[model samples]
Target chain A: MSQIVCDSSSIISLSENCLLNLLPRFKVDFVVPRSVEKELVDKPLRVDEFEFKALRLREAINEGIIQVKDVPGVHKRAEQILAEANSLFTPRIKILHEGEAECMAMLELTDVNTLLVDERTTRLIIEDIIALGNFIQSRASFKLRMDREKAMALQERFSDVTVLRSTELIAVAYEKGLLNNLGDGHLLHASLYALKYSGCAITKGEIKEYLQLLK
Target chain B: MKKEFVEKLKKAFLHGDARGLKEISNESAEQAVLSRDKEMVLISLVSYALYKMLTKPHYHYAPGWSDFVKEVVSHLELCIKDPRAIQEALGKRLIEDIAKMDKLHGRFMGDLIERARVKQASRAYAMGLSLDSAAELTGADRFRLYAYIGRTRIHEEIPARSVRDRYERAKEVLG
Candidate 1:
């Protein structure tokens, strides 16, 4: 019953795929942290290609399709979560970034129920700690399960934060008839595959399965 | 020893002239299409493609591409001095490129980079490298590599597994 809170990755995914315009039609207000907005709109502007995408994101904001808000007290919590999350995986190698924590902070301070993210590490961090623990244990390189107390704290602190990729967002929008004009009768398939080729990390077989469900 | 020829080839690539290399390869294609000369020709083509990739002004500073170009240029320098150094040099360059590709390309550049990977992979396959080897070099996702690898000149077979099969494999290992 809460609004959709997204990170830079989801927006970047959609923007890279030329699907940013379709975002407004998702029928829910989209909120990103100020840091995430900086990532979306500023840091990438140095590159010619991303500068164009950043402009589109700026337009989405100016058009009122997206909202950028700074969540209070979220940074502290997010930093804590990031430390715990990184420790769960390979040490000395950071697995999540500040913007992910910002998204979580938004979730914590606001009523957002879902996090729209695209990166695997951040998604794994927020998915299910127990599953992640089992995964690390099964690997020879990672012999220890994540520290129990920290893992439990993370599990409890952000357990309500569900994550969805841009792929699912498009799928849901297609199902909801939000992307009806995207193409012909095969628009759904076309759109799904377009997302894949544009770096959604979705598989063709998975797209087929979802297409079946859409029908 | 073809040192000067290899150096010129390296220059043509680092200088970002695809057409120049293409014309050069076309000339050599017939002369060495089947002889020991083919090895040099294949190496030249690979260098051409890699040059077109790393020298493109658009994504010049990307971490992944930058790392690749750095490794490649060092290898190319070695390769020019000793044309016999192609396999070890370029092979190492390719593996580093794959490992660094998460920094691969910024958003708008995905399409361009993917195109470069496919073109690069085509040359690698024609040179008789395996899919894994090509993937390591091109820095393309294995899934995308598998999808683009059909009809490659390499002709080596890979498992025709579904995405579910990959997922099952993941579960088997992680469980």
Candidate 2:
């Protein structure tokens, strides 16, 4: 059987769309860390529609169609990782965001092969490779510096320029009657990709297009 | 989008006004039926999550954050119960739909502890999230907070002494 773990974003999105009923269609075991559960339960809703859907999803969970799991050893693994992460280098070449560090811990601890992540910074940090380069003299003395110009350039050129397209996302919304108008569908789709790829240095031009569509 | 709407939602969440919270929650359910737009859906989701975080206090606090977070949460609650009531009636169906979409964000949510905002939010969320309530909201199994922290690696050390010291304090709550 294929198994999957869910993140809060997916959970909220699924819930809001009222498509959570479709979980059985995929027959996947949706697991979430205890922290995520806590995270959503405490968070206040900004949209009336989202809150209502969240409440319903909450009820569905109570009904037991969707099973939420807290993987064991997650905490121990996180602690170990934190310790290792903190001691990674002499002064530490890079600092991991709290979520990134936690995610790295989760990836290490869990045996799952795929993760449905949307954060841009996490993806870059995970994919980018950088190291110290030759020293350069600027007026006084030569100093060794971490040269990530290549990686930075790559990100600037391609990271945000590309987009992840999912026919399922658009199709599903249509099927559920979630797309009320042309503007609604276009803007909503744009926002989904926008927030997901926000860390990629995407151009303002694209964002403006999306915002305009919504208007 | 509207300033008045945002203000109203903000008020409801910060005050833990269950009446307003419930009203908005209903509206979100109704709207999900007609508007299939994912972005609007997400904006709505953020609001709901924020409200839940604020309305309840079930964990430890770092002093100043409680008020600040609560204030933000209140704003979200009003959005859910806007006067329009676009999606309030659908309720459970809406949630089920969202649950299905949640798979898309599973990786992101699973990796939240690695993010700074999520880390801080998780800490704040825990304070307001009872184990039972949290489980109900995110479809998460019952697990001790410490265990989740361990999984996130927040329990681990940092290169900076100051950062490490603060992490230690957050860890104490789990212990």
Candidate 3:
């Protein structure tokens, strides 16, 4: 019964795969900032799979499956950054700038056990903060047990007892037809990236080779 | 590389001349799409111009088209003679333009800056907008924030530096 407070990236990624359906199975009460909700739902939906997720996210909110928590003081900070940012750089970076801050804040406020984010810089900053020995109990990405479970479920032959690598898991996902036309590859890629940062011995070559067969 | 080319770009951008832009666009796209050197320099130049244009409307609008063009042409000419001059000029221009925009926009701008500043100062604040703005303004890599939290668990093992240094003789190790 872990209370999972997800950043926009996790929600967007999960929803895109229509994997928000998986939340109830985990029985994790998920919280997202109102800013994240607005970001996903406020704008007109685009033609991409991302837009599909946005609509689904809105539906999840309506059903009360996912709770929205808006961080106060975020708006004021966003406004300040936007004004200066536009005067300095392109607006394309605007959402990301705020999303990163919001993600960190949400983790702090919820005291959540784990954080789920895909951005490299955000991941790096979290690692830096952790290196400073500030908070005592927080994790990022999938827990080792969770990764093992996912790998097991992904393939019968993956041998759950053996330490199957991310590349092997990806290959299994490919063989099982789970990666076909699915946007979740990005999630897999994010996980792999995080694993690499964590010093996993998994080679990307195997993953790429497996990915070639996915389509 | 040519004085005329620089003059043309200066005139086009200062005037917001769609036609002059059309010409510049065609040439650059050709260079970008076909050039052997990959036209990295030209890409940088175009990026500089676009960055300036999007960020500083007031400055672009201030001198009217012609005077701005003359100023830009002179700047480019200086840059051609000494490349470092362009880097310095670009930095100077950006700071000046940003400062002026900040001054002219006043409270409207003030509010945004304040918002971004608050997010920077407080770990509790979590607005996507504010964080995005702060990162852009501060030029800090935003992703580092996530990694910071993930790595900060107090109970975790001493980091790679100490552990690795004990095993490897030559690796760089932090105390």
Candidate 4:
């Protein structure tokens, strides 16, 4: 069985797209780590606009659709390194978050082989080494700094993991006969784009490709 | 893009009119659907909205609330040409300039950038940009933006039952 742990980004994408209620439809168990729970619930609830989503997330937790787990200790062990890697990216584009780190840790402790993450920084660091280096090189070139060592360190530290965006999940649900209700074959395209605008990081080409593949 | 509106907005900022600032925020929020809050106009609008929330009259000042507001308005004097850049610079300055204070005053100025991001996240999401696209525009992490979007979704009436129905329809069309 395939298992996945979610960072808040994927959760938010699902929520914003009106797809949170459909998590059980997926073949995978959508696990939410503790820190992510706080970001989605505790902190945002303080603001008026975020209150509703937080409450809904709270309800999801109650129903066991979005399972909130206490982060394992390995998450803490990974913290120093994750923080180091996070610092490597400039503040303007830093990708490390406690919730994301916790998801990564869950990967180590469980059979979870993939992490559903939405942020580019962590994804690039783990999955796309060259792009990550180019990002550093481009930024470093601007500052006249050699970023090879730093970039290499970040890559080596987190280079083994696979990252998936919330968009792919939407695609999966679509392929599974779950999203057919969105209205004909058009919903696939519409929902994919919806996730994009609503905050899923998949690109237009990817959406096009997925739609074509499904066809 | 409306010069008159910008001027009125500037005046509202100068006066620390929380209500007026909020009105500006609301008006800008509506623009997301039209794709009108281009190049950070939406971002600036959010900053003002955050300002309104942080400085509400009923909330007693912790200590540096007034100073934070003053400092934010002070930057209005320079470089309004790019409202987004000005807001970003103001946010950076506020974080740098906010003095030590009790939690009551809140780090009104220090959180300018973050609050702006939060607001930007909301605006970008509201504008029909996906989480990825919206996150890209605002430079906010997806999770953080999701939190923002989650809150906004509370009032939104999403047709939750449509995905399966739509998929079935698409299959027939494709077939």
Candidate 5:
């Protein structure tokens, strides 16, 4: 069975939309780092607003639908990635957080080449550093200094990692006929938008195109 | 925060200058984007709440309005005196106080703060933080943030590979 490393963003999105069942249906191992489990289950469990969602995720983990894995050297690797990625722009804003860095580290140290993340920043950092840098500079009021070499190095490290969002996962499920019972005509369309509103980083244009292709 | 900025913020609070507070909030948000300082982000958020409290007629006439404003002003005075030690706590306390006010009065105050958070989170996303990261920093709901973000051109500004290609790639990998 193949394994895909999960991040907190995707898990939270999936959980919020009641899509955690899709994990076991995939027949692939869905693993999260320890830190991600804290974000998904531990921390949220304490807050009243998110307590129910946290319980759902915790139940999924308890039932063995989602596995929690701790890989060696992940912390050290995460720190290194944080240092390099954080320093990529002058005036050094912390673009990546500890949870994201841990996810990247888990992807690097393990054999899992596929990363299931819903956030655009990590996906952009891996897939297109130049574009990410340009986007950052465009958003900032002050002129930003880009460290090209650092961006290049980080990109090279994550070059082979395949990034996918919760939206795609739901789309894949739709294509596989798992969503047939949810209503046929508008199921795919509604599901895609549901994921988008639930924190998947897919664009409206992208959803429109998906409807054209998949419908 | 610089002493000058704190002083200005205090002056805005003292004078009930909603417009000035809004401007400070914008300036602080920009600084947060550049510096990635959580304190700056908090300042932006608190300033925005203050702006709303001052400008919104409902909040002004609400019960305990005077006490709340006076308390916030006192907090600002402390912030001016020792920003490093007091700013983050003041920001958090303001949010908590607003929550309490909402409970005591009605849901109106809570709605205002939620809107403020969503607005600030949108600004953060526009200023280049990922949707999730921005939401994390601002305590905004990701669902609401994405909904707000979808209506803007931020997605267009940073185009990604086509969804079809990415979908095909996802199919290949997951299969």
Candidate 6:
């Protein structure tokens, strides 16, 4: 089966919306790196508000629905990506974290080319770094600086990668009749919005379009 | 941060100047976004929390309010002297103090701090950092941040890739 490396953002969104069942329903393998597992389960298990969500993720792990793979040499690759990606902008604020880096490392080191991430930055970094820079510049009151060569290099590195949000996954599930039991007419609409509110980096306009296409 | 900014922050906290604290918080938040400095983000969050405490009638009149204010002011003084050395300590101590105060007074000061974090994180998001980056820097929950961000015009301002194209790609990849 084709594997999709899962990031904590997508898993959290899925777990928050009680969509873990969709993992097994898909024909592909749903894999997460060890660091993402820590974010999803280990660290969150100690916090009261997130304990139940952690438990739900842990249960999915126990059931073999979600596989946690500790990719060897992942740390080195992650650090390299971190250094490269973080340095792409001047004044060098870290744009990526360990967990997200690990997911990317796993993708690079393994056969996985598709990353299931709900966060906007990582997707933007891979799919459209220039647009990402534009978005960041638009929000910044001060003049934003970018190293064009580094941006191009980083973008070239991950050009083959496919990024998908939980919203897209839900839309796929809707198309495949996986979400039918939830009721027909409004299932896709409600699920998409739930994923959005739950932290999927999808716009309201996109959700409306999905509703129009799928409905 | 500049010495003047630190001094102004110290003065604001010393006098319980809620408006000044609010303004400083906004300034700090903007700097946090520009510099990507975690300390600036913490300062913004702490300043906002202090502002809320001083402004809320119930919190202002609470018995331990003066004590809490004094503790925060002392931390700010240390920040003025050595911000790099004191920022982390101030953040930890502020949380500990708020937790203690909440327990002692049956107040929601800890929740206030959390709200301040989410609000500051949203501000960071609005200022141009990605939502995840903002939440990661400010220690805000992504779920809460997204909920807060959805209420704003941030998403509408950015041009996103076509949903149809992305959805098609997702289907092909998964299949």
Off by over 4 Å in 5: B14-16, B36-38, B82-85, B88-99, B106-119, B135-156
In the range A75-154, model 3's lDDT, one tens digit per residue, is: 66545533332232111223235554554455544445344443332332333323311211122111111122322232
> Which is the better candidate, 1 or 2, if ranked by TM-score?
1
Which CAPRI quality tier does the interface of model 6 achieve? medium
Give the per-residue lDDT digits (tens) of candidate 2, residues A54-156.
Answer: 4665676677545555666777765654454323323222222233344444555666433333222233333332321111111112232333554354334
Interface RMSD of each: 13.9, 21.7, 17.4, 12.6, 2.4, 2.2
Candidate 2 share of real interface contacts: 0.00
Where's the lowest-lDDT run of ten residues in candidate 6 chain B?
A: B101-110
Error of 2 at B43 (Å): 29
Task: Write one digit per residue (lDDT tens) for candidate 4, span A1-215.
Answer: 35567887777777877788777765566777787788778876876656887888888888888888765585775586456554553332334445556676777666666677764545655665456545444422233232557767666755545566676666667777788676665878888777766645555555666777777
Assess the local accuracy of residue A137 in candidate 3 as a C-alpha lDDT between 0 and 100: 18
Q: For model 6, how does the per-residue alpha-carbon lDDT over B13-70 read when each residue is reduced to its tens digit?
A: 7787889999988888888766777777777877787787677677767787788877
| Quality of candidate 5 docking, DockQ | 0.50
Write down the lDDT of every candidate, Cα atoms only.
Answer: 0.57, 0.37, 0.40, 0.57, 0.80, 0.79
Best by DockQ: 6
Q: Output the lDDT of residue A100, model 4.
A: 59
> What TM-score would every model get versus the actual structure?
0.55, 0.35, 0.36, 0.58, 0.90, 0.90
Candidates arranged by DockQ, highest first: 6, 5, 3, 4, 1, 2
For residues B99-144, write the lDDT of model 4, one tens digit per residue: 2232344434434445555666566444333344445445554455
Worst 10 residues of 1 chain A by lDDT: A136-145
lDDT ranking of the models: 5, 6, 4, 1, 3, 2
After TM-score superposition, the amount by which residue A77's alpha carbon in candidate 2 deviates from its true location, in angstroms, is 0.8
Candidate 1 wrong stretches, greater than 4 Å? A90-92, A133-145, B1-175
lDDT of 2 by residue, B115-171 (tens): 222332233222222222223333332222222432342212111122222223222
B-chain TM-score of model 6: 0.79
Candidate 4, residue B60: how far the Cα is off, in Å: 28
